[model samples]
Structure formats: C-alpha cells, structure tokens
Target: MSGATGAAPSDNPQDGERGELSIPSRRPRRLRTTPAMRNFTAETDLNPRSFVLPMFVADGIAEPKPISSLPGVVQHTTDSLLRAVEEALAAGVGSIDLFGVPQEQTKDALGSAGIDPHGVLNRALADVRQRFGDDIVLMADTCLDEFTDHGHCGVLGQDRYGNQIVDNDATLTQYADMAVAQARAGAHVVSPSGMMDGQVRVIREALDAAGYADVSIMAYSAKYASAFYGPFREAVGSSLVGDRKTYQQDPRNRRESLLETELDVAEGADFVMVKPAMPYLDVLREVAAASPVPVAAYQVSGEYAMISAAAANGWIDGDAAILESLTSIRRAGADIVLTYWATHAAKLLRQGR
Candidate 1:
C-alpha cells in the first residue's frame, strides 16, 4: 500500500536473508565501464604528436652501435639514421632531436668542432634537412659537452681563488656560433641545454643576425643536476671527472624553476624545457603553468634504463609502463615529451593499446 507521501515501500525481509542495500546515487564508475569510454573521457591529449624522439648519430662508425646503457637504442650511422628516421616517420613520430657523438680525436678545449660546418652534428643536420625538407622538425643539441674533451658544457677557467669553473661568458660566444651553425645546417630548432645564464638572448640575437630569424630556440630552462644522467654520459662518451653542479639546477630547489623559466621566456625562448621529467614533474607543472610558450620535458636515459631493466626481469609490463610514464608526463602539463621510446610508443598508440 502506498503512503500519503506516495513513496515506494521498503523491501520485505521475507524476500532475502539480507534486508536492503543502500546503493550510491552518485556513482562515478559509469565512465569506467569500457576502454572506449575511458579513452573518450581522457583529459590529456596523449598521442603520437606529443613525442619528440631523441636520436644519437655518431661520427666514423661503420655500423650502428647499440648503447648498453640504453637498451634498444643505438648510435646510428648516417645511413642507419636515415632508415631510423624513416621508421619513426612511418610510426607517426614527426619530430626528432639529434645529438652527435664525435670521435675522441676531434675533442678540443674550446669545442670548436661543434661550430664547424663539417662537424658530425652539422653534417647530420644538413643531411636530414636535405632528405626530409619540411617533412620533419629537426632539432639540434646546441651544447659543447660532447665536443669538448674536458666534458664540461663550457670552456673551463679559474676563479679568483684558482678554482676551476665553467666560463659562462665565453660559453655564450660559443653557443651563439653553435646555434647559427645548426641553423645554417637547417635545424628547425636549436636547444641550448648547457644551463648557461643569458644563453637564450645570445642565441636569439645570433640567429636573427644570421638571417635565420624563424629558427626557434628550445631553452633548457629548468635542467637539474641529477645523478640520473649517468646513462646519457655513457651514450655521449663524456670525459668529465667531476660533476656539473655549478651550472645545472640543484634538485632541492622548486621555486628556482620559475625564475629560470621567466628569464628564458623574457629572453625569447620559443619553448622551455625541464630535464629528467619523472623526478621533477612538480617543477614541470609549475613551469608549464607559468610559461607563455610550449613547455617540454625530457624522459631522460636513466629513467628509461631503470624501467627497461625492470621490465626485462618480468617485474612489470613494459608496454603499459611506457604509456603510463608518457601519460603521467602529459598529465603533469608538458606539451612535448622528449623520449627514447617515441617511435615504439607511437606504434602502440596506433594499435590503441
């Protein structure tokens, strides 16, 4: 019988041993029912377009040499690099940041080879530009660490107390030349990753003066001095005996990133980046929110190495972890992610996995 209020009557105890259940009126699980639904509801635009593959091209290598530290990644010869680029393009990765591994014999204190037109990096840039034209966004690593025998980002000098230090002012001159050379070789973007102060202004002025006014600058605005760069050191064959704590940001500082980012943007950086993305997602988030231009994060070599090793040991699902890592970075607000797994992840995304 209905009451005066006309509400439904409660269930009789005779219907079941358990009386009545209280169901939630606001169930959030409605959106979690299917993979299609989840994908449709995804907040972040995680796709192939978000990745920027970082590739290494070595000088004087007859064959592609595998990097033991970075599993499944190789230092490609010019021919192998083209093939790799083709594969990346086929997989829907449209951008690549190139790093050149020069021969040890070419190393010099001033890293003058980095500015030479025939240097390994410039040669690869020219070749890729010629082969692909505007089919891809070619980025060059505009730093001297790889070319300098001392393994510092800049030329070394002594402080008043005779303590060896990076010559920040001298390095800017080198960076200006390096940026122009990369631009001449047809790099669409030149990334100044040495963490030198005023680098963005110097490079911008140089690029404009050289008539490559359209070339973009991707400044490493919040690069940290993390120990996680060990694998990258091996990949680039760095010859440093000490650390780069002097230039790179300290891991302990969070607000420091905003300061660095503000300066880069003010100095005309087209894009600013945070290195070793996973460990510094907080910093990435802050920079992304504050920056006027697009922000990028690097999924550095050590991050890749640890994940690959754990996956190889059957500790985790490699494919899922890769996507999750990238997704996490995207969620943290990075517009572009520089990863070693760009091509592989692109393929997986196409497969809808």
Candidate 2:
C-alpha cells in the first residue's frame, strides 16, 4: 500500500506528467499573479466605443455653462457642441447622443418646433454632421419632452370632461415626422425615447418613405418613468406641472419591460434600450438577453447627478466610481451605454483602464 501496491500511474493527462505536481496552495490566484495575466483572463472588457456621450446644446449660450444638478456636465452652444464632439473623438468616444435646449417661449402645447427643420435640435444636428462628416455616429434623441411646453413625451389631449391624457395615435404621427426630420438632418441614428406604442414601426416606415432608409432606429423600448430624471428636466428646461404616470410604466412592473422589448423588436427596432441603467440592471440584463438586435442602456441624468454630488462632497473617489459604474453597466450585458460620463470614461479607458 505504501510503495509497490500504490495505484499505477494513470493514462490521464494530469497523471502522465513527468514533472512533480506543482499545484499552488492558493489555487486560481496563480493565474492572477500579474497584471498581464489578469487582463488576459478578464471575461468582460469595456472600451470607449461602448460608451455613447449625451450632450445638451443650448440655442444661445456662447460659453459652456455647467449644469447645476450634474457637476462637470454642461449645456453647450452650437459652436461648443461641435468642439465637444471633437474632444470626444479625440478621447476615443465613437458615439454621441444630442439633445437641444429650446427657449421657454419656443416650447408649446403641441411641441411643433420638435419637427421644424430650423429648430434648435435640427440645426445643431446639421452643424455637427457637416463638421464631423460621418467620422463619428451622430445620434438624435427623438422625443418631444424637451421641446414640449408641458414636458410630456408626446402631445397631450383632453377627455370629454377636459381632463388631460396622452393621445397615442396622435403622438405616433408626430414621432414619425420627428424621425424623418432627424434623419434628413443627418443623424446616423434616431433614438425614439417617447415610449409610444408602435413608435418604431411608424418611424421606420416614415424614414423609409422619406428616402432615409439608411438611418438606424434606436428604440427606448423599456424606458420606465422614473424619478431619476429630476436633473434632466432642469437640463432641458422642462415646464412640466405634473408627472408622466399615465403614459410611463409603473416601477412595480418588471415583466412589462420584456413585453415592451418584444413589441419593439417586432416593430423592426434596430436596437432596444432600458433607461436609468444603474437601478434597472436586471431589466437591462433581461432585455439584452432576449433582444435580437444590439442592446443599449441609458445612465440617465439623475444617476449622474447623485454620483457627482456625492463625489464632490468628498464622499467618494469620482474617477474611480465613474469607471466602476460604467464597467458594471457593460458587465450587465449592455452592448452600448448612453452616459453623461462617456468622454471622461473614454479618457480613462484610453489611458489603460
């Protein structure tokens, strides 16, 4: 039993090795002993290309003004927006999502300026496209909320008794017009964040009919009505007097997001997205798992504001937290993430993670 009677050398690869067994006491730590090893073994990697920067371009500001709620983020003028695009491209960010700030006087009940070719957003898109010349992906946010006087995602309606409600059919027509306008303005992708039913199909057909078949559609399929958008309303100068509860899904419902994603896919959406990425990683993961096209998640303004506020107060390391948060989003199965920290994150990523 001690010597000659011991089990014979096995034919298995492990047993046939001629050298002495070199198993380390600490197990898998051996593989992670060096930076090169750790990097090589990493299961998921995040890069600047995965991050999409969301920018707000105001109509009249000459100097970039910092958003009070979102530290380090700014409302840029058209000239500054182009400069920002150049900075983002230099930092390795490949995609940019644009939002425009309309003057208070321009916002109206119907948000008619949203589809106007000469409106703030449309004009800004044309300027950016002309300057960039397709070097980067220019994405337009196709939602009426920023342009609407009431701050609702769509045009509002009234019941027989004069109570306010969203007219789904009426909104779809508006979204279709908005989509075509954005496409014609040279947006590589038109992201419909209105959450209206059949919005994807309507916008897709509208773009195709208008000879913009080359433009892509990024649908905000599972955008939930969340309180995290507090800072965003301010950034866009929303004049909302009430909540969007009637049109937006309740936070209590999770399964509804899947249904929304399913409907969006069926409507020919090229990409499906879940908004407010941090708190809804489960929804993001679910959508990413089930979606046939690329899945994106939006790290909305509220998410950015809270983190920035905390970091500014000396509560946390800002740079570290930003990278970690973005990495977590990518790890949650989002192929692309629309984030306010995109340029900063890209700079950090390009500097070797």
Q: State residue 261's C-alpha deviation in candidate 2, in Å.
A: 0.6
The regions of model 2 sitting more than 4 angstroms off are: 1-26, 160-162
Error of 2 at 3 (Å): 37
Best by TM-score: 1
TM-score of each predicted structure versus truth: 0.94, 0.91
Across 320-342, the per-residue lDDT of candidate 2 in tens digits comes to 99888987898999999999988
Local distance difference test, each candidate: 0.93, 0.89
Per-candidate RMSD, Å = 5.2, 6.8
